[model samples]
Target: MNVAVSNNTTQPAPRVIKHRAWGRFKRNKMAVVGLVIMVALILLALFAPLIATHDPAEQDLLQRLKPPSKEHWFGTDDLGRDLFSRVLYGARVSLSVGIFSVLFNVIIGVIVGSIAGYYGGKTDSILMRFVDMMLAFPQFFLLIAVVTLFKPSLFNIIVVFVVFGWMGKSRLLRGQIMSVKNREYVDAARTIGMSDFRIIFVHILPNAIAPVIVSATLQMGGMILSESTLSFLGLGIQPPFASWGNILQSAQNLTVMTKAPWVPIIPGFMIFLTIMCFNFIGDGLRNAFDSR
Candidate 1:
């Protein structure tokens, strides 16, 4: 009877990785806006076939050079293709190139960087020097040079982008891993006789991956721009395929630039919008991951 009643209090649950990251991300207003716009663009691209009123590649010489109107929301291009439909389809190409190229670049970079960083001395020296050698080349020049050597198709262009893009990310993750490899948890894992692979992949990478995530997000816009640049130069995503860059290729003509300004403006704005949104989201992720 004298034992008295015990107090009952609920403990707060731990925050999830995604929830925590999202909480931090939403704090940035510009990032939230960027996320919204990015999602909308992605959806627009995904549903282009259904949303598009006309065939993106179908040409009608009679409708060519028409300005924005009820019949054609973005009007018609020089080929008399519906600009609105082409723009939507272009989003799929540009976005896919950006995403796939960046993904492969990050995977290769992370693997190379992790191996070099975890196993130091000669391994680090050789790998870091190789990265430096790759970096010494002017990236754009190198990109153009390599791209010119291959067939100008979507797959070839992505492969070329991946080849050049990994160097920076490798250097970034290598530095991050070096900083993190000596931490106490890593030492603890080592003390327990954990395999080198597990220690690096499981213990070390989770902590070091923040910078890589930020780097990858920031690089997306650049990747998209690079793809666009190549397409503009006729070195990527050949004709009949809609891409923001190839769409803008029309503006190279003075007549088209003067008479059908919408041809370039629409794609140009799309590129600008996509890049800014990616940058905003990158900044948000950087802030979100920053514990300070």
Candidate 2:
């Protein structure tokens, strides 16, 4: 009897497995670095005003294209606005777009995916087909059309991103739900007369959302990239509102590029570094959640 009990107890509990996953995540040095970078950027964005020595929009043409120095650590742009200040303000735009757009994507995705996947058959066919059609469209042209139709602003950029972004997330979560909904525990939950909502969210979502979390994290970086691209194209938030892309736009002038190379370099570095950090964290999550 004692031997049989010991054999049966050998399997680890779910919480124990999760704790082990966290331990594994901590063991990855790159993940820790990414987390630190993410936190630091968040702090910088939140404290932009406090950290910036000058107003981001307060440009002085007289001091335009100045090199990096004590008075202007990141130098001045062609308009004479403080580059460091603009970069900090830009962080606010980038992080806001990334975070809120992902939030909208995840929420709408989880709901749509859960419904289609759990109900399956006609519902699944219709929704997945819609997702496919949306994905098939050339997104760049769509963005251009939409941005042109409306005045470009931070809110418009985020809204446009969320409108296009949720399709991918919905498809991802639908696949996860399809795989998870057939599990024995899920069947048991259904067998017990649990409400559909309870079965889908309470039981299945907890088990299935790990991948979605990682996807959202990675997507946040993509959102930042999109904002930068849009802003670079002059179809995003207009001037007077500094973002990384428009900040770099100053470098288009040969005088600014040569006289104050810092015009583009600093913001470019921030974008590169932020994307890398998000990718590192996504990789860490992938490794940590591997069932094997």
Q: What TM-score does structure 1 among the candidates reach?
A: 0.91
Candidate 1 lDDT trough over 10 residues, lowest sum: 2-11
Q: lDDT by residue for model 1 over 1-292, one digit each (tens)?
A: 1111111111111245557777999999999999999999999999999999999989999998899999899988888999999899999999988889899999999999998999989999999999999888898988888889877888888888898889888888998999988866677668769999999998778777878888888899999999999899988777788899999986688888999999899999999999999999999999987766
lDDT of 2 at 193: 89
Report the lDDT tens digits of candidate 2 across residue range 1-292: 5433543464344577678778878888998899899999999999998999999999698998888899999988888888989999999999999999999999999998999989999999998898888899888789889998999999988898888888877888898999878866776667668999999988788777878888998988998998888888888878899999887775788877777778889999999999999998988887787767
Superposition error at 54 for model 1 (Å)? 1.4
Where does candidate 2 stray beyond 4 Å? 1-17
Error of 2 at 157 (Å): 0.7
TM-score of each: 0.91, 0.93
Where is the poorest 10-residue window by lDDT in model 2?
Answer: 3-12
**lDDT against the true structure, each candidate:** 0.87, 0.86
Show the colliding residue pairs in model 1.
Answer: none
